[model samples]
Structure formats: structure tokens, C-alpha cells
Target chain A: MARKLYELAHSRAGDKGDVLMLSLIPYEEEMYEKLREQVTADRVKSHLNHIVKGDVIRYEMPNISALQFVCQGALLGGVTTSLGMDTHGKTLSYALLEMEVDL
Target chain B: MLRIGSGAGFSGDRIEPAIELAEKGKLDYLVLECLAERTIALAQKRKKADVMLGYDPLLEKRIRSLLPALLKNNVRLVTNMGAANPIGGAQKIIEIAEELGLKVKVAAVTGDDVLPYVFENADSLLFNPELFETASILSANAYMGVSEIVPALETGADVIITGRVADPSLFLAPMIHHFGWSVDDYDLMAKGTVIGHLLECAGQLTGGYFADPKKKDVNGLAYLGFPLAEVQSDGSALLTKVPGTGGTLTLRTVKEQLLYEVMDPSSYITPDVVADFTTVSLREDREDRILLTGGRGKERPAQLKVSVGYDAGFIGEGEITYAGENAYGRAELAGAIVKERISRNYDEFKVDYIGAISGHRGSFGHQVNPYEVRLRVAGKTFEEDKAQRIGEEVEALYTNGPAGGGGARKFVNEVIGIVSTMVPRTVINAAIKVMEVGQNGKETV
Candidate 1:
């Protein structure tokens, strides 16, 4: 079965400098492995290539059953220096949730 | 057993919610973390102009509305609203107490300014390296911890004001002051830091910022309640809100906030301790209570995070809208015209035809042309007049543009922003002073 990432997980975003961090936690503990296999830096980078200009780094948190994505050079130049409205890139976590996963 | 309430998370947070927390939350400590990365720098700018304006703008409003209740509840207040000038902020609060005819003690924490040290190490701290020789910094302050704050809390100060302390430290100081927790106890410090981190954002931890509609459903968010940490002596915290308030307390919301702004789960750096978010686990102890456990901490970092504020010049933006037949074409033409006119004034400018490919970062042209579109031109320049010129060039498109170009608007605003860097702990030498209300309903420093 195929489902949207939002269907399997919920996420939140925070920022440091121009870098944005997104945490994706699964709805169920069982879904963590599926997310681990399906979600990768490449997929996330490609999925958000529309806005993310820099590299995307993904860290696995098996203990918490979550994935943290650190997207660099994403805020046009970062919040203080950026002209973009989504300065903190709070909306990007939802954009990551929009990703689809095959279960 | 100590209960700390989060009155505010950031500078512009809603004030009424804090009033509710002060009146009904039954809190021992009400901590408001208002200063952000760049707020102090901006506050310094305000202070340079007027001695009275450097603190948080809502300092009086927050005090006027919540002070009486806060005093009635015996819930001492602590906040970094002191921003760039804690002394001025404390004086303002003392004046408020006088005007209200209420007696309360206030404390102002100082010595975080490191501008002199920044100048000494200017070559190393420049974000652009080129700024080492050329740019003069506007403000520089080190992120302080609980060293000065705990003593102030011990002085029985009803209100504690600080400048540039770590956000969680605002909450952690009360914990240490009341519980007699040793500052060197990394495990307890980490646990307390976890509590501070959770409640620092105020509403974000309690589902106000975690709602996703279908995926996550929050109730009555219009009046979302702030967070409260019921912390035990053993370093365990049960997070809840003033029951009967808006918002949800789910495992999901707790989990999101648990990792908010964390660089590494194993090592979340702060001035106080290198908190380990990985060790902590969340469990729903009840409908509205989430228990946080297993938090451990390591030694504190050697370098405290320093926020460097410098002038980023002025940002001038102009926008125009287009509709009807050939709207996309007309908008694109308008963008081209503005770009040609504005680029000559500055070396660079951004032109976004904000409907077809604006969101895509203009990487690929959209096959489906939008029925209506907006043309926006924006850029940063050292001169305010040059930034203003960017908008004027766009307005020129009204007469020089294709059919149906309308809604032309432009404005310019100066930008004050912080650059990321670090400094040694010796640079900040944080100090604390207590100010109180005299018997004549006047302030005594």
C-alpha cells in the first residue's frame, strides 16, 4: 500500500542561522523501519528541490523512532539576511510531510 | 516540588494568555523568554536612540495586566525581556509597581555585552570575513546561563530581568534557586534544561504550533493556554497546561517540541550543559499530562554562543498585480522592465513573477500560465535611498508596462540582523543587582 508521509507521520520545524531542521515522527512505532528504509537524504532533497538550494542531511533517531532533516542554505541566505516570507522555514516540515511512502 | 509557567516564548507573543496563567495556573515561577537571536541587537539600536526604549515593547503591558495577579498568586516572574538594557527594564517595572501602588522586588542581570571583546577578536568573528576590516558591528552579547540569575532569585526578587541569557536558563534559574540543586549536577541540570527547552517556546510545546488539521487536531486554539512544568526534585518533569484552556497535550506535540532546534539528539549544546535529547522519553501519564524521563547531560560547552548584530542595510520591496487575458505575459514583461531599470542602480536584484514559478525558485518555467500574477522586485543596499529606488523602478511599470498592470506598491525598511558566532565564557562576566520598591511607593535601586 502507498500512503503520503503525513498519513504515517507528523512533523515540526526549527531553525538555526540559515539552516532548517525538520523532525518526522511516525504515527506508530512499527512504521519507523518503513520510514528508515524509504526516507533518505536524496529523496528529501529531490522532493524539496523546488525551494531548498543547499544540501539536505538526514539523521536517524531509532531510539525516538524519528528522522531529523537538517536542510542547509535553504532560507535564501538565512532568516536575518533572507527576503523570503517563510524566514524560519516553518512550512518546510509540512512540505516534508507531503512526501509519499510505500508501505 | 516546583511549578514553573511559561508566560511568553518570544517578544511578540500574545499577552492575554500570560494573564490567564498568572491568575489561575498556581505557579511558583512564571518565566517569560522573550529575547530571540536578533531582538537584543535591535533593542540596543532602540536604546542608542532613547534610554527608555531598549526593553521589550510589551514589558509594561505584560506587567500591567499580569502583575497584580502574579503578585497575588505569589508566582515570582523571570524573563529575558531586559534585552539589551536590564537596568532600564528593571527601572520600568519598578515604576510600574509604583504606579500600581504595589510593592515588589525586581532584579536585573547584566554583563553579557562583549562588544569590546568582539572588537578585539574582530578578525575571527566576522561572518563574511571581509567585514573584519570593513564593517563595524552594531551589537555583540554572549548567551549567559543561570550563574547570575540564581542569586537574584535567592534574593527574593519578585521579578527577574536579564539580557541575552539562554532561553531555557530563564526557566532553569528558578528551578535551581528553589530546589537547592547544585549547578554542577549535570544530570539534574540537563533535566531542568529539558524542561526549559520544552516550555521556552510557550505555546509550541502544547499543540498551538503543532496543529496539522487532519493529521493533528487541536481545540480552541484561538485561546491556547501556555505551558507549565511540574518538576520534581529527581529531575523528572510532567508538562501540562492550565486545565480547561485551548490546545491539545498529545505525545505528538510533546515529541515535536522535544527536538525543536536540537542540532544532535545525543548532544544539544547550551551554555549550561550539553543536554542529551536522546536519553529523554515521553509518556502520556494522563489526558493532559506528558511525563519526561531519562534526561542526562554532559559538561557545558567551552564557547558560549554569541549573537553579532550588524547593519544588513535596507530592504526595499515593490509589488504589482496583473489579471485578465495575457496576465502572465503582462506580469512577466513588467518584471523584466523593473529588473532592467533596478539592476542598473544596484549590482543585483530579484524579480519574481509570483504565480507561475515564484514558489519553484524560478528553476523551471510552469507549463500552465496563471490567470492572474504578481510582479515583485526586492533587494538590499547599503544606502536607504538606493533601496527606495528599487521600488520606484517597479512603480514606473504602471506607465511603461503592458495592458492591465495595477496594484503597484513599494516600501523600504532598515534591517538589523544577527550573525552566528561563539565566544569564551570569560568574555561575559555576568552580574546581578536587585532593585526594590521603597515605602513611599517609589523605586529603590
Candidate 2:
């Protein structure tokens, strides 16, 4: 059975201009490889297709057991210009966590 | 080892936690990093309105509240609360110190405002065309490095304030001053920079933003504690917070904050160093304490990034709530009415069913059956009147479309768009001015 990303890991979202940086940390250190394998830029880009309008890039932090997804053109022109209520895209991490994953 | 506490993480952070740190936490320095990317631009707007009003609005309140406890504990303060006016901010601090009958030396680090240089070298700057094009520029500030702040600390000033200096550099400067770390020592700079980054967001490191209810519960959130770091000469630090204060400091909180607002962790660029967050390692030293080590840095970037705030028209917003049966449908209907009513007049229009899909923009799909929902309609337009109309349409729903629509609210904000560009590092120069007040309340500069 497939599981939600939230059940296997935790995440946090931050913004820099129109770019959104979302950090994904697995609940257990052993799950790091699984998250890295299943959670790709394409998967995340498709998962947040509505909110993100540009490219998605991923960076790994093996020592910290985490993956950072840098989503471009994600904030509808970011905090200053975005018409959306969540201008900072702070809630998108939960939205990303809603993606289903094979654990 | 130098014990440094964080008084604030942002411009409008809580004041009581900082007071608590000063009153109890044994510390050498308390850094209150209060500037955000768009904040200086907003401050520029205020400075235009009044010459002396551009600094952080809470400067007086924070200074007044923390002065006694800070002085009593000998905890020197280093903050970027100056916003767009470090000199004015320092003067305000001196005034507050005089009012409290306390002797103090406050140093204001200037030269971050690079509007003139930006205009002179506008064509040469690396522009992000997507963010703005020929808009009226409001403010341009270069992120200064530790070189500017060390002199201020060298003056033996009780407080150091700056404007537009990099957030991590605010914490890194004291380490460079106290430990005598060379700027070229990239590894040490990286290590210190990581320490700065970790403690910069005071409460976040203490689980302020980490609460997930049953999944990731954090206790005492009402009075959440702020973070502090005990730095060793070798560049490793022990991160913790005041005991018995609200919030938990664990590996989970530390992990989350380590990458907060960070992009490309291997090359987290700052004016002082290019810190590699990938090299960092965290260990639980004991209860409420995490020992962090293994941060590395590379040579600093040749050019400094400048944040430019420009006038970007206006944002008009309106929201109305609907509850009871078929609340989502009512809210959706209300949104359709507003969009049909006036969306064609604006350059950009957005309709959001607040409870159903506003935040994710329908990416997560709609809630099956929401008990209540808010209909929000917003737009971007050049004219203020056009912006104001977005809210007017939604408010009309109280009588026209939705039966249960209530609590209508409207807002129109003059939009300021913040974009980034890179300028030669040499174009930026940092200068410091020291102000003092004696116990007798005589002021000197």
C-alpha cells in the first residue's frame, strides 16, 4: 500500500523571492534513501503543479538526512507581489506532503 | 567559549523572551536579527514620509524594555533593527538609554544603502527581469559582511546596530571579533556562519514553528523559548535555550531550522563566506541541547547581491465568510459573482475559496465537506480605485449571492515588489558611528 509523504517524513517550506525552498526530513534515518529515491523533482513538480509554475531543483544533505526542493516561479511573484493569501507559500510544504509515496 | 543569546528573530518578534534571556541567560552577546528582504524597502517608504522614522518601529519599545535587564546582565546587543536608518536607530537607542539613566555606547554601522551606486551601475547589475521592469525603485541595500561590524564591536559599544547587513553576518561578526578568525579562513567562517544561521531565528530553533500536534508535538508553545549558542574557539557550538521557558529544543527542531529559507545548502552565499550546509552534523548533547559541528565554507562571492524594492501597483483584497450546509458551494458561488462582477478591469485577478483551496490553489483538491468557508477575491491593478473595487464586489455578496455570507472584510495595499541584483563587492563600503550617554544623562557622539 502506498503511504502519504507526511507519514514517512516531515517538511518545512520557506521562500526567497519567487522561489520556494521546501525541506523534507524523514522520520527515521533509514527512510532517507527511500525518500530520496521516490521523491524526485518531477514528482514534486507534478504534485504542486497548481502552485508552482516553473522549474523544480533538488539538493541533498546526507549528513543531516534531508532533501531540499527549490521550486521556482512558485509564489505567484512572491510575497510582495503575490495575490494569493499565503504569499510566503508557507503552507505549500503541507500541500507537498500530501503526495503519495511508496515506502 | 562565548555564550550568545538571540533576543529576536525578526522585526516584530516577541519582547518578553528577549527580556527573559537577558535577565537569566548568562551571555556575552544577544543578537536580534530583525531585517527581512522587503523590510528595508518598506522602511524606505517610512523614511520618505519622515526623515527620522525609517528604523524598526519597535526599536524604542525593544530598547526600552531590554535596556535594564541587558545592562544588568552585561549582555551586549547586536541587531539589524536599524532597517533603512541605522544612524537614526542608534540615536533612538541613545535617547532611550538616557531616559533610563543608564550609561551605554551604541554603534551604528552604515553604508549598506546602495541606491546611488545601483543607479550609477544599473546596466551592469545582474537583473532578474521576471521580477520587475522599469518600475520606480524604492530602495536598494547591499548585504554587508563582518568587516563592517568588527569595527563597531571593537569600539567597546554596548550595542551594535546595522541596516541591510546579511542576517548570518550579524551573528558572525562577534565571533570574528572575539575569536580573531581571519576572513580568508573559509572553513572557520563557514562553521561560524552556520552557528549564526542556527541561532538567527531565535524561536524557530526552539520549536516555535515546528508544532504538528500529535505527530510532532512541542510543549509550552504559548511562552516559546528563544535559542542561544555557546561557541567554542574551534568553531563548534552548543545550541539551546533558557530552561523552563516554553518550547522544546530537540533534533527535530534543529533539523527543520537548519535549512529554513536556505537554498542550495552546499553554497549558502553570504558576504563573508559561502557556507556549505551539507557538511553540518548535529548531535544531541543532552536534554534541551544540541551539539552542532562540521560546517565548512568556501571563498566568498565576488559580487554582493542587492535587494531592490520597487513600486509595483496595488493589491486589492476582499474576503467574506459562509457557514452551515453547503458552505463550500456558497463560498464558491460568492467567488464566481465577484470575478464576473469586476475581474476584467484588473491586470490580474484571483479568486480563492479560503477553506477549500486558497492556499494550495486547488492543488490539494477541495475539502469534501467544510463546515465553513471564506470567499476571497483579490486583484492587481495600477489604479488604487480599481484595487479597492475587488473588495467592494465581495462585500456585496452579503446581500446578492450567498445567503449566509457574513463578516465581510476588505483591504487595499500599495504593492511593493522586491527583486534582487548583484553589484561588484567594491561598490559597497561600510562605516560606523558611535554614540554614547553617561549615567548623568549627558549625550555624546
Using lDDT, give the best candidate's number.
2
Each prediction's fraction of true contacts recovered: 0.45, 0.92
Per-model TM-score on C-alpha atoms: 0.94, 0.97
Candidate 2 TM-score, C-alpha based: 0.97
- Name the lDDT value of residue B90 in candidate 2: 92
Q: What is the DockQ of each candidate?
A: 0.53, 0.86
lDDT of 2 by residue, A1-103 (tens): 7999989888889999889999999989899998999999999999988878999999998998999999999998778888888999999889889999975
Docking quality tier of candidate 1? Answer: medium
The models' CA-based lDDT, in order, is: 0.84, 0.89
TM-score of chain B of each: 0.94, 0.97
Candidate 2 lDDT by residue in tens digits, B1-445:
9999998998989999999899888989999989988889999999999999899999999999999988888999999999999999999998888878889999999988999987776666636544456467889999998988999999999999999998889888999999998989999999999999888889999988899989999899999989899999999999999899999998888999998999889999999999999999999989899999998899999988899888899999999999999898888888888888888898899988777777877746543677998888889988999888888888888778879889999999988888788888778778889989995565656
Q: Superpose all Cα atoms of candidate 2 onto the true structure and report the RMSD in Å to 1 decimal.
A: 1.5
What is the alpha-carbon interface RMSD for each candidate?
Answer: 2.6, 0.9
